[model samples]
Structure formats: structure tokens, C-alpha cells
Target chain A: MPDTPAIEVRGVTRLFESRKGFLFREHTRTEALRGVDLAVRSGSIYGLLGPNGAGKTTLVKILSTLLLPTSGSARVLGHDVVEDSEWLRPRIGLVLGGERGLYNRVSARDNLRYFADLYGIPGGEREARIAAVLERVDLLAAADRRVEEFSRGMKQKLHIARGILHRPEVLFLDEPTIGLDPKSARETRKLVRSLVSDGVTILLTTHYMFEAEELCPEIAVLSKGRIVAHDTVAGLRQLVGGDRTLEAEAYGFDDREVDAVRRLPGVSKVVSEEYGPRTRLTLRLRSLQTSPDDVAAALPGHSELSVRERRTSLEDVYLDLVEEEAH
Target chain B: MTTVEVPRISRSRATSASLRLSFLMFMADPQWLIPSMIAPVVFGLVAFELFRGSGPYYLTYAILGAGMMSMWGQTLYGSGWAIGQDREFGTLEPTVQSPTPYVYVVLGRVLWNVISGLIGGGIVYLVVLAAAGSPPAVPDPVGFVVLFVFVMLTLASVGILFSAAWVYTRYSGFIQNVGEFAFYVGTGCMFPVVLLPFWTNPIALIFPPTWALDALRYLAIPGYVGFGWGFWPDIAGAVATTAIYVAIASTVFKRVELHVLSKGDLSDY
Candidate 1:
């Protein structure tokens, strides 16, 4: 019990070999994870946030014993991942990304039972666990229907049931709510929250910043195989200074004009995207410091500019982080 | 609220669950059950009719050959299909993540398939024997029982071998097609190894099912005992080959699983 760290990963690196291009005959090594050191405390919902290809899933896979790191080491619930993998398997539950985890041909009840058996739950106990999860996910009524006949939400629920069927101490959910509709997304968030309340440690990875903001008590922003930032939601907000973003819609404004506005004093970061005939720009400034005067005066000859100041959110923080990495 | 009851999992219970799951998966599919019963019966009947004038020789040949065919088909396809479905559905990782040992999980599946294979093949062998109206030829009951045990273990490993291929490639269709085709054309399921080329004959003998079929034919038919005795060397070869294959494949499969996990390729399309 003393060995259990909920989940422990230290200096883990994973590299994959791939063909570089048509002309390039030599295979290139892509480092999926690079010397990552992380620890998720017991009874906490840990959010691993990163841009696409930042190796969040790779880290999860390593901890779950699905993949071996090229270097470094990891442990789960006090078991050495390489040496004591068999011991680690039972203590953790994982819902991998994509829709391939559920038996599309079988009903939810049957699928859960199959996993329950795989986990070595007694028949009577397995059935009871299946029923409880089905009810929890509101899939009890449709437990007997083939998963192929289910909507996206139903299949996702069945997957959740499969993951936690063994009641693992630590649960890994990789992009659990991806592609879900608003209603189903809301429901999944609630389910995740409830699981954490039940004292199960959860490690979730997502590109969506707000998803982490809502679910995780502690957040790690992973970019380019490094921990760019790690802190609570409030701490992350503090990293961006104030909690407000300034936006301006200007028609007939050229790229140079937008560039000039970006260079204005007190502007933390600026992003501009063209929408039809108009250019919409958002500037991350120190609260309401960047005013209409800042936009108008900076733009010089542009008179058709309209400016609006809005509060900052996780999305702004995320874009700025990725944008900084790009520069 | 004071909890009235709660469910807890143990190693013994997990094994039973995995076994039950394996059984239910094979049973629920009609495609598996029907073919298993039908092919062996048909082969038995054809063998009986063709060699009626040839006497007990033909009857023994048909029973053994048909039984091996049916059982091998069950073991091979059962393992391939179930594992294929796991990879397809993304349940492979979840299953691996469970507390159950990987050995038990896989063995449960292989053993369940072996039982089904035996039942399917046994029925066919019985049907053919009854039609030919022949008495049992094998004098030693113990030898026959040992043959069945060796046959099950050797043949079961073949499933594990194919499952390794399925894991790395993620090619279910290719695995199924090649497995079906090999049983029909290459493995001597359709015709005896004697009809094949001089070199191919010994190679066919290396598969445990081929030896089991030969033994079954020898035991069930009069005057066919020589051919069954001749197949013992092949049985030894099959057992040896299968053990090596299982050892290698299990290691390989575990490695790939780790690669998929560490690279986070599990979510990659």
C-alpha cells in the first residue's frame, strides 16, 4: 500500500520509427514522449493537457503498461511497470480513445459481463456490478441491445462500464468526451466528477482546455514533449495575468495593419483570422488596458474598426500557449 | 446509507468470468456452431460411402480426418475471430489492463474453443462411425485418452500463434482468409497428406491436428491402425513446434502491446 502513488511516471520517453518521406529512404525517429516525470496523487482528478502530437496519450499508455518507454521507468499503484506489470494491470482501468473499445455486435450488458469475467469477478458479483454501471450511465434499459444499434453516446457509456467493471483504483480516460454532443458531453462530465467523488484517482488527457478546467483539480500543460506549465485552474489563469481578452472586427484591414496592432504596448499576444471579407482579431492584454484607442491609434488609417473587450478563458490561454510554441 | 452489499473480485472469480465470456462469445455466433457440426458430418458420410467396398479402412480414414478438420477449424478460427474482434472493438487493452493474468485470459479463450472444437468434431466422428457400422479399433483406452490430451494442447497453441500475428498487423480479414485457406488447401484437411507432394507430406505431419486425425482414423476403423501408428512421429513434431511458437509469439505480442501503449497508438486510427 505504501508503494502506491495512484500513478507514478518518471523520466519516461517513447520513440517511434517512421519513414520520413518519399525521397527520404532512411527512417526517422519520432520521440513521442521525452523524459516526462509526473505523479498523480491518490483521490485526485489529474488533467494532462497538450496540443496534438504532444505525447499525452503516450504517457498514459506507458503508465497503463500498454507501451514500454524507450528510456526511463514508470510504476502504477506501487508496481514496477516492466517488472511487476501483471500486478499493475488489476489496479487500473483505461478507456482508450476512439470508438473501437465496445463490442458493436453485443449488448452493453453482455460486453460488461465479458470484461467482468476477464477481470475475474464472480458471476453473481459481475452481474451486479454490470447492472449498477448500466444504471449509472442510464443505459440499463438498452443493456440488451446491440452496440451497433446504439447512438454514439450509448457506445461511449458501455465503454465506461467496461473500464471500471473491475473497480480499479486509478482510471485513465483518454479523450473520453471527444465528438460527443452537448447533452451527452454534459452527462459524461458529470459521470467523471462522480467517479472522482467516489475517491478514484482519474487521469484524463484532452486537447480541449476547458474540459480539463472543469474536471481536473491539477492541470499539466504538455507541449513539445515537455511540461510547459503545471498548476491548478486558478494558477493557470494567473499565468495569463488578467481574466479579460480584447477583440476587434475590422473590414478592409490588411495583414500589416493587424501586425501593427499586435505590436501595441501592453499587448501580451495577438491572433488574427480572416472571416470572409473581414478580419477578426483577438488580443490578450492585461485586462481592459488594451482599449479602442489602442486598436484605432495603432491601426492608423483604418476607420471601419470595431473593438469589443471580453473576459479571458482557458481557450485564450491555450491558443496563446500553442502560438508561443509556434513562434 | 449503510451498504447492504458490494461486489469484490478475486483471481478464481476472474478466471471463471473470462472462461464464461469466451464460451458465450463462441456460442452466440451461429456461423461458428453450425459449420462446426455440419462439415465433419458431411466428410464422415462421404468417406464412408466412397470406401464402403474398401471396408473399415475408409471408415477410419473418414472419422479421423473429419474430426481433425472440424477441431482445427474451431480452434484456429475461434482464436482468430475472438482476438480480431477484441482489436477491432478496442477491448484488447481494457482486457489487458484487468487484474487477470494475460496467460489465464488467453488460455480461457483457447480452452473454450478447444472444447467447442471437440464437441463439433466428435459429433461428426460419431455420425460417420455409426453410418459405417464399425466397432472401435484401438485396443488401449489410455493411449487414446492421452492422444486427445496432447492433441488439445498442441492444437490450442496454434490459436495463440495466429493471435500474435493478428495483434501486430491488425489484419483480421487477412488472418481469417489465410487460416481458412490453409486448413482447406495446405493443412491436408480436405485430403490426406499422402496425396500431397513428398516434401509437403512431412510438413503437414508437423501440425498436431494432422496427427490427431490420423490417430482417430486408426482407432475408429479396422485395418487403418498402421496409418495412425505411422502418425505418432508427426504428433511429437507438432507438440514440439507448437511449444516453440507459443513461447515466441507470447513475448512478441506483449512487446507490441507495450509499444502501442507507450506511443499512445491505441487511439491512433
Candidate 2:
């Protein structure tokens, strides 16, 4: 039981149907999720990285029991998401962060009170629990303020506050730090870390690569309704071909020059892109055997040639995986 | 690391909390009451003017008609509107995601609407009494009060069933609005079902409010010939129809919940 994954998804797919036209209806079906499989360990933060419309929100909604998958199955803490939603609901906290999904007219405290009751938080501890979550989210000062008057950041904080008010065993955060200032976003990331320390398994969806690299021990890259890659930051960097990236730029690179650079020792992949008149070849290396000098040596006789080497980042890994999936 | 023990969901607690939340929302913006009151007051004045010279018991008919109309607006339209607000507020998903069943939440709103509908009914009573210059003569005042409350229960049952439509679609409010006057005419809110075409009576009888309102009229108006079946059968019909509505509401709410989940459109509005 201890080794069992906190969240397990297997070949899960979701399709959305829409009808257009008034008199003669034309039905269209969209595959929001496509045979997605994933596993998140307990007491850990797992990051889901994807471009827009990559089915991150759809996956989160399905895991949170707000939507059902059309095929396959997903389970949280050993309970099937579809069949055991009611049993799982109280134990799972969901924060689909945005400007909406809050009672704008009522005080933040009142909104929490309403949800606390809905979650069946004991009457004896309801107020204290609300106060604790507000304090945890740093909204204690604005607890009595109407949500309509709160800033976007404050509303997001309240959304988190509501999510964790019940102290769920698992929490699903869909872009929790979106639209937040640096300081607020850092605070939210810190809050997420703290929740994990408290033994909450978190499946976090974020567009920020740095945030994912910093918080999640394991990350999954989703593209076009499918999981292209799932690994730790280092594992992802390795999967995308290496830990180091070398950039070589010149006015033009012939096929022979490009092939020579691609054949260099430790060079796993070489991607070329055109910027106006110059072509930039980005080489991913698995080992440090290939250096800037080596790259420059491989493509000689070019006065405009410039070679540089740096560590491959999570951003590079994410882009590589997403682009590969797109192709 | 505070651990939250999963608490058992109490349907009664959820319903009561929903009722309290609705009350708080209403208090925050009391202007909503003005629009809800307008229809009832207009109906009361119009009915009293038409019934003033008809007969001695005509005042009772007018008051009953207006009162039932007022409760219908509150218990039915108001309950459905609460759900529509949930959709617009983006709260429907979280509320549905909670451990509490959606029916309990709707029941809470219906309960609040029933209370407000009574207030609307009381307002109509005062407005009609003022217009006619005297209260309707009643042989059994206690029975009238009891029957009025029962009529609201019938309306509450129908309201519960109607609120499901709001959950089933974002366009439900428009559908309800278009059907509003039809419901009034069908249920014979401003007149007895018998006064309409004989063919319409069977259709009207399906609505619990029709049977309940007819019984209320029988108790309030002497020589009232509703169904020509007297008081007991009217009460029986109201009870049977109300039970059916409640049963259908339970099943329909479950299906609506599933439909929204399968469609994944709880927040589409």
C-alpha cells in the first residue's frame, strides 16, 4: 500500500461532442484526452506540462471527478475515479485556478463557510479550519472582504484556500500560479510544497517550466491529448537527448557541415532553425566530450560561425518533447 | 500536517446550509424581491377588480387565485433561477463535485423559495384585502391557513422537479420563461381548472398545484364545485400527484447529474 501510486491513470480517453446550427444540427466530436497513462507517487508533487489545449485541464477535471473519461480508467488512492467518485470526493481537493469559480459577491470567509458545510467539515472545527486555510494562503487580512473587491491574486489565493480547507489527501491544481506576480507566485509554489510536506499528493498542471522543475520531482509533458514524456527533470533532459546543449550559428550551413556537426562525439541530436539569413544549429550532447571548440572545429571555414555551450533546461526538454509529439 | 478525517455527508446539513446561503445571498441584494413581488401584486389587483361584483364569495376566489400565483412564481421560478445563478457564478462544478448530492442542494433552495413564496402570498393577501376593502369571509380560518401551507408544499414538489431542468441545460431559464404563462394557464393559477375547457382539466390535474389549489378553493369558497368530488378526493389527488413529482425529481436529479458529468459541461455556462 505504501508503494502503490497515489494516482494511477491507464489508457484513459475523453471525447467532447458539440452540436452546431439551429435548424439542421451538425454534430462534431473532439478528443480531449487520448489514451493517457500516468502514475504519481504519494506525498510528492507531480507536474503536468503542456501547451494550450493539451488536455491538461481535461485530465484534471476527470481526476477530480468533475468529468468522466470516455474509455479506460483512472484511480486515486486505489479508488476508481468513475465508480468511487463520491467516496473519493471528500478526500481530494481540486483547484481549477482562474478569475472565475468563486462567489464574487460574498466575503471570502462566508464563501469558505458555505463550502465547509458542503464538505461536511465538522461544525466544531469549521471556523478554525477556514481560518487556518486563509492564514495558510496569506488571505487572513482579507478574509472578511468581498471576493469581487479582491485582486486577481487574492481570488486565486482564496481558490486555493477553499481547495485545501478540508485538508484532502490529494490535491489537483490546474495552473495555480497563473496571472500571479512573482512574489505571489513564489508564495503559491511554497504553499504547494508545504501541502506536499503535509502528506498531500499533488498533481500540478503549469505552463511555467521553472516552476515545474523547482517543485515537481516527476513531470509529464502532454501534447495533443497524449502524454509524450513522463520523467523527472533530469530524466526528461536526458530523454530529449542530453544534459548539455551547444549552439552553432553561421550565415549558412551546407548539408555536409550540418552532418559533420551531427556526427560529433557525444552529440545526440542537432536541430537547425533559420533566423533571417543565418542558420542556428542546436546540438544536444549526452556527455561533455563535445565542447564549443569542438563544435567550431567540426564546422570550419566560416567567419560568421559562433559556437556556445550551456546546460539544457527543462524548458528545452518540454519544447523538444512537445515539438516531437506535434511532428 | 493536519489530517482531515473524511466527515460523513449529512443531507439535512447540506440542505440547511444551502438554505442559509440562499438567504444570505438574498439579503445581500434585496432588490431581487421587488421584481418577484411585482407579478403577484399585479395579479392580486386585477383579480380583485374582476371579482368584486361577481358574488359574496368572489373575494375569496380572487385572493386564492392571486395567492397561488404569487407562491407559484417564488417556489418555481425562484428555485430554477438559483440554479441558473450557480451556473453563471461558476460554482456549479464545485458544488456538484462535493460529497453532498445535488438534490439536497436544490431542496435547500426550494425550501428558501417556499418561505419567500409564503411571504409573497402574504403580500398578495394584504394587497387584495386593501383593494376589496375587506378580507374574504371564511367559515374555517384555521383550515384555510393549513390548506394554504399544503398548497405551497405541492408547489415545492413541482419546484424541485423544475429545478432539474436548470441543471440539465444552460438554456433552461429561457425555456422556463417561455413556458411561464403556459404553466400559469395550465395550472389555472388565476381561475379554477373547470372554468377552462373540459378537455384541459385532465391535463391540469397532472399538476399537484391544480389539485391542491382546487382543494384550497373548496375550503375557502362555499358551494365551490371543484371536480364535484368534494374535499377528500382533492386532497388525495394533491397528495398522489405531489408524491409522484417528488419521486420523479429524485430520479431526474440523478440522471441530470450523470448527464452533466458525462457531457463534462457543468461549467459550460
**Scored by CA lDDT, what does every candidate get?**
0.72, 0.91
Question: Residue by residue across B1-269, what tens digits does model 1's lDDT show?
Answer: 01112244465556566567777666666776575777767766776676566553555556555666677777777777766667666777776666564545666777788888788767876887689676445556567667765676677877777666565556655757766866645565545666677787666755656665455444444455333346555556666777776786678777766655554445332
Model 1: how far residue B27 lies from native, Å: 3.9
Write the residue-wise lDDT of candidate 2 on A156-229 in tens digits.
Answer: 99999999988899999999999999999999999999999988999999999999999999999999999999
> In model 2, which runs have C-alpha deviations exceeding 4 angstroms?
A250-252, A276-278, A301-305, B1-4
lDDT of 2: 0.91
TM-score of each: 0.83, 0.96
Candidate 1's docking class is acceptable
> Per-residue lDDT of A150-214 in model 1, one digit per residue for the tens?
88877787778777777777889988888788888889889999999997889999877778888
User: Compared to the true structure, candidate 1 yields what TM-score?
Assistant: 0.83
Q: Distance from true position, residue B10, model 1, in Å?
A: 6.0
